[model samples]
Target: MIAQIGDRLVLEGTHLGDARRIGIVVAVAHADGTPPYEVRWLDTGRTSLIFPGAEARIENRHPDETSEPAR
Candidate 1:
């Protein structure tokens, strides 16, 4: 994912009936938009650094828009 600061990261649950996890990217660790992103979770308002797996997707935030991911 070509994520930047303010982009939302949505982690789709692997198991059946599991809930998805959503968060905003607060910091980007590298210039190429690789992993080890610092994200702030929507549900708990907590922050964490993550290296995403196959279950994750990125929601880009346009320069002129404000976006919020689904809970």
Candidate 2:
């Protein structure tokens, strides 16, 4: 998947009862916005370089005024 800095990377759990993990993309390895992103996780406050898996999805950044309402 393609992502930009500041976009949220959400990794859904593979098993039942596992919590979803969320992180912000701090750096992008490719100019075209491909994987190997440097992400800072919200839960652990740690950074990691990730080539995202099938369970991962991107949430693009948006202005406060233009953002959708929380579900």
Candidate 3:
């Protein structure tokens, strides 16, 4: 679930009309290094940043992942 430079962030697969998208974590923001990643979701050929917290998992990005709003 950890997001990395090649991990895929899948959102609402079946319930959301089977809508699926993929992207790479271009950047990560974390202080203590824990859950919640500032993911840059590549949706529908476009790029969108997100901080999917407890609602998400970490299986790719480094351990120093955070949810700080990108500036």
Task: Measure candidate 1: CA RMSD.
Answer: 2.1
lDDT of each: 0.90, 0.89, 0.50
lDDT (Cα, tens digit) per residue for candidate 1, span 38-64: 999998999999999999999888788
RMSD (Cα, Å) for all candidates, in order, is 2.1, 3.6, 8.1
- The C-alpha local distance difference test score for the whole of candidate 1 amounts to 0.90
| Candidate 1 runs further than 4 Å off | 66-71
- The deviation in Å at residue 63 for candidate 2 is 4.1
TM-score per model over all chains: 0.86, 0.86, 0.43
Residues 1-71, model 2: lDDT tens digits: 99988889999999999999999898999999999999988888899999999999999988563432243
Off by over 4 Å in 3: 14-16, 31-43, 53-71
Top candidate (lDDT): 1
Indicate the TM-score of model 1: 0.86
- 53 in model 1: Cα distance from truth in Å? 0.6
Specify the poorest-scoring 10-residue window by lDDT in model 1: 62-71
Model 3 clash pairs?
A: 1-58, 1-59, 2-58, 2-59, 2-60, 2-61, 3-61
Q: How many clashes show up per model?
A: 0, 0, 7
